[model samples]
Target: MLSPRFQGLKIIVSDSAMRELFKLGKDMHDVLEVLESGYDAPRKRKAGTIERWLDKGKKTVNAIIALDYNETMQEECWVLVHFGKFARNKK
Candidate 1:
């Protein structure tokens, strides 16, 4: 389950991101937590993103989300398209 903060926005995880999630030992909750509280990745310009940094042990994971609408469902959703850039933790 997700928090009410998400409200009407649907949450989706990409197929490749699923593998990365396992590699980082993270789940949807962890991903949501990171999205809820974020650090702006000003340098990254992937798919016109609202960027955020997520940490997992020695590596820092990137959570790239894209906003999209479901015309058929008549609702908006946030897609976790990419989540596999494991850089060294900055802080």
Candidate 2:
């Protein structure tokens, strides 16, 4: 449910991701902050989901957001596909 500051960019949060956000231990507000700030960097087309360290705190949250541009609107479309926390070792 987050929108980009730039009008040219259209970001969408998947329904499944939204439902699982609580597991990330971060509220929507915090996610918006990190995502908005990430806009400063250039986003490229992505398909393969990969976990990247979010530049928010001490590298805690790992999220995968795929990017694809819409030719009709000529705008960048970002979709937050998935996210999760680091797992602790269990013995």
Candidate 3:
């Protein structure tokens, strides 16, 4: 189950990320679900970069997001930069 706290969080997806999702035949709702329920941790890519991992059936999906804490909105905004099936040491 997704937490109620996530209900107010704003989600933003980049154009490239959207294209990747379309190419992978993945749904935005599924990605949002992952963001809402997955375990998240800070990434070394940048100061605000975060990596969210979600287990779907037997596979794990990873979403890289840039988090912004908005004072006016009083909510955390997530900008999805990349997302795909978890690949270990592909680079």
Candidate 4:
């Protein structure tokens, strides 16, 4: 059983994607923590979730791109992971 703190996270992921991303490798929570800390640490701590930070990061990255600015691949990956479209290829 997960803590009530994590209950808010339940709806963040779809059933299928949650199953896929929840177990087999990187825990989504940990990933969200990392990304959230990178972008917004204090706010993340308050919300007890990283979803908003991830959304902000995505918006920031897109804004940068839209402005015809350059961002590193690493920067783009932050937004991509939340999307669940491309899973990291196991090597």
* Error of model 1, residue 16, in angstroms: 1.5
Clashing pairs in 3: none
Better of 1 and 4 by lDDT: 1
- Candidate 1: RMSD to truth: 3.3
Model 1 spans with C-alpha error above 4 angstroms: 1-8, 44-48, 55-58, 89-91
Candidate 2, residues 1-91, lDDT tens digits: the string is 4455323446566787776686666655565555544433234434533334445444445455667666766877766676555543345
> For candidate 1, what is the lDDT?
0.70
lDDT comparing candidate 3 with the true structure: 0.73
lDDT per prediction? 0.70, 0.55, 0.73, 0.31
Q: Per-residue CA lDDT of candidate 3, range 1-91, in tens?
A: 4422334666677799999788888867878777778987445567767777887776678878787776766878877789888544434
TM-score on alpha carbons, each prediction:
0.70, 0.50, 0.63, 0.26
Instruction: Judge candidate 2 at residue 25 and give its lDDT.
Output: 63
- Cα deviation of 64, candidate 2, in Å: 0.9
**After superposing candidate 2, which stretches have Cα over 4 Å from the reference?**
5-8, 32-51, 55-59, 69-75, 88-91
Which scores greater on TM-score, model 1 or model 4?
A: 1
For model 2, name the residue pairs that clash. none
Count of clashing residue pairs in every prediction: 0, 0, 0, 0
Candidate 4's C-alpha runs over 4 A off are 4-12, 19-24, 40-91
